[model samples]
Target: MNRPTLTRVLVANRGEIACRVMRTAKAMGMTTVAVHSTIDRDARHSREADIRVDLGGSKASESYLNIDKIIAAALSSGAQAIHPGYGFLSENAGFARAIEQAGLIFLGPPASAIDAMGSKSAAKALMETAGVPLVPGYHGEAQDADTFRAAAERIGYPVLLKATAGGGGKGMKVVERESELAEALASAQREAQSSFGDSRMLVEKYVLQPRHVEIQVFADQHGHCLYLNERDCSIQRRHQKVVEEAPAPGLTPALRQAMGESAVRAAQAIGYVGAGTVEFLLDARGEFFFMEMNTRLQVEHPVTEAITGLDLVAWQIRVAQGEPLPLTQAQVPLNGHAIEVRLYAEDPDNEFLPATGTLALYRESNPGPGKRVDSGVAEGDSVSPFYDPMLGKLIAWGEDREQARLRLLSMLDEFAVGGVRTNLAFLRRIIGHPAFAKAELDTGFIPRHQAELLPPPTPLPEAFWQQAAQAWVRTQPDQGLWTSGNGLRLGLPAETVLHLRSRDQHQVVHALAATDGQGIRQGETVYVRWEGEVHGVSLFDPIAQADASHTTQGGLTAPMNGSIVRVMVQAGQSVEAGTALVVLEAMKMEHSIRAPAAGVVKGVTCQEGEMVSEGSVLVEME
Candidate 1:
């Protein structure tokens, strides 16, 4: 049924996903309104939309996720619908119900579907009742230690403790042994309460070497539903997916058919309407178990879009407009390989801690034959400490997986970022890994190669020499280095030394080594000769504008701007290298900063009460 057209849509989200939805909404002839927080006033999404609404504060509670505020924005802007582009209130069933109550269309699954999947335990029960395969675990309300211990014992060791109310790798822990059960349980509860406002949890058998796969399904009010194939999201850290790909490598046709069927069945079971994702954990033996269902568009939906050549956002709007699915399941064609890597504003070397700062420069790689970038920031956008660390997603499609991976790697290497810390190298490393190339991955992929994935700081490549040389030449008044070498240096001999910090260790780079004609010894110090001024080049992390710093006696420096969420120790407290010093929340995820060296906490500069910028002193150890 082709119904009345929606004239306008309000994006009930900020950042990249908001920009993503706005692009499709505008292209589909719908005027777009962006709802943003004070921190996001200058956000790219706000600028891209036809109208903008300031939701007020930087914190999520004050803005993006505020259901009432979002509805008001939509109604005020004359938007006929609201598109929650993942996260925040996307899966909040109450939000959907509210939208319907307000007589506005929600471009997502029905409130019933959201309610069915909003609670993990409830969803599991629903899936189990529907005869869908599920991981064996306890989903009861027993929270006592003895009861939990008994349940764990029953489920056997290596069980997973997961928060029942939320997704994203938050509030989840893998217990490898009985000794860690209690701590894991408590931690899971704490994280759950903090993230989802619920402390309830459930346990399930941990599938070692399991693959994370999900199928995208679409449904309409006309009783038409279809599956859009599958996406492999096994490349993960902390149980949260970091990379996603369509047409999973090594996925046999038989397994794909089985997974897709299961996904459809799951959707049909919930009377799912609009777009939803059925996630599954595929074990080594090709056995798949339903993990949970995401009742909204996924962060990695672009891969599915690339392969099927279908615009999911547009489809979501059309379906909301009462249009039946245009294609049947049989017509949902899957073509080409598409991979997406999430570029985050986090320090990979520092336990992938969330980072916050201005994106001094944000550059998007041009979508060539098989590349696309969905971003919410432009140059000079500040990555606020209160939001998720993700800057944007870089997606590439190719005739095959290797071509896509290769293209993505090249794009990652060429991409440049100059503010705060980010994981460009980390992403490049994952794509470059042989196991990744061969699709030999599981949940344990990062752990098996943890050392390599987060490699210690090494010397910068000669390419740095070229960039610095060019920069220095440009700064010079006369001589262009590419043309003449004489103008490259000042007449007076000078030396500059920079102390670079990487992985919390300091290394001094001599910018210029002094020389006396041939060589000179000042007392016992010998000055050696070098060509031009020493560039002091070191490993340059994309988002980290400057990793070099001067060391002080009080505390280790905060590498980027952030707020201290938790201070684990006080002055004179003994600590170890990996001891949690303070927890910092930046770019929307929590970062547990550990001590860089084993020593006594001599001083602390960052307080739980104040905001600290990059390079601000945090805690000093003696």
Candidate 2:
């Protein structure tokens, strides 16, 4: 049968994944159409496309996840194919079926395969029947409190409650004891419903000291399928992967071949085409259990491409156009090592909370040979609260593991972000850890090194204060007379006072100059190098709070820009320390605001389902 050509493609996604797919599609000479939300009209991915379609909403449900809007955009843009890039509607079987029924190419596995593995419970049951090794768990169809509780009891304590249709760690909770099971299950189900529209959960025994390994499998319509090695995604936080590396550090030839073959068998059994990842939990005894399979291209696919020199996006498009597999399993090349880190716009010090602000100073690492930076936002762009907080990805490839590791570390150092808190420094620590260097990996990697990874807060040094003073001087025309051309102050010591802030700490220091000799200004920020270290400080303009309506002397305020999902306590309610008062959700993660002390709630100012600003008072305590 002759297949229709796919020359024009519409990417039905947003952010870095959209940009990544567009790059490959454009390189393949296909016209790329980008569908964007109202908030992302000027985003990097929107600008990367040949033609843009406005989805006309700020939220994911109103825009990207709306199958009708995506289909209409593809049809109106004169595109012949649609690529669902990794999230949102990528794993939605109904969306895939709609695209195919509309006479457009769906650049992924068939809707049948998507349905086969769409839910954790369904997928596990199917995998068990296929003779694939599965972790001991309950994949029952009944979705009730009593049923789940009984299942958890049978599975034993310390089980994991995972949303049946979850990805990216949204609907995952670990219940260490019997008492924690109820809250964990409820939160997991709520998050699962909010994110994936499925609240049904599956309970599984939590594995100890297990490495999260996944095999990259590709298949074509002509009965050709092969595995593209594997990736180690053991380093994770909050059930989401933070770092990934290709050719898992210490896999024996026999074990590697077995896993790869098993992944291929799994894909073939479902007639899966395009890119997919078969995840497995590797234990300390070298035993493995099948985890849920992701039927879409993974966020960490770049490492697989870097090591194999294969563009999985291009492969997806080609396979959708009825092309045969580009290479056989024997012909697949496994070259040098590659490592990737997901840089998120989040405050790791603040319990890994998502941060929202403009990218006042977003500088990406230079993408030299074997170095790649895939990002969706540029400098001056706003990091909104409507979506995931992942800012971009940094990937590096080198001749050896050490070379890759060292190069990645240098690239991370060069990558800078401003105007918002990020996990940049924390990522550096993970890569620099001695255990990481020696390839000691597991799901507990981050928790084991929490003290080293999350260092105690230290006060800013004198140099930081000095730099702030110098920056303040340069910004003031009247103060310029006090400093020399070389950034040194000719005036007396403590001639000026500097009010500076870092993260949330405000400091007042009396200093004269930013430096003793030299300094440079970039935009509103000034950089000073002293004592063999360079410090960059931005002039802080504190808002004059005339009314203070958003703040209370003794009140709990909203910690971020999010909606109040729940109010656990009401007005005049007595609460003890650590008692949850309100629950706030932002970027798909839930944060509970607890009572600061044993006190009576004077009033409840916020209500459930209402959007609140960062500093709006939620409840007052007296």
Query: What is the per-residue lDDT of model 2 for residues 266-287, given as tens digits with 9 covering 90 to 100?
Result: 8998999899999999987778
Q: What lDDT is reached at residue 395 by model 2? A: 96
Worst 10 residues of 1 by lDDT: 525-534
Candidate 2: the clashing residue pairs are 470-514
Error of 1 at 621 (Å): 6.2
What is candidate 1's lDDT per residue for 1-622, written digit by digit as tens? 6656899999898889999998988787889999889978888898999999999986777787678898998899899888988877888889999999998988888888888887788899998898888998988877787787888899898898888776888788889888888866776776676566678898998878888989998989987777898999998998888999998888998888888888888888888898889999988888889988889899999999999999999889988888888998889888989999998887776677777767655556655788898887887787777777788999999899999999998788656665556787788888898889988878789889888787675664444433433333333334333344344356743444444333333344444422212222222211221221112223334335455644576467776666676777899889877887876655444556678778899877777747777777788788
Say what the RMSD of model 1 is: 6.9
Tell me the deviation in Å of residue 113 in model 2. Answer: 0.4
After superposition, which runs of candidate 1 have C-alpha atoms over 4 Å from their true positions? 1-3, 143-147, 178-183, 459-467, 474-560, 563-582, 593-622
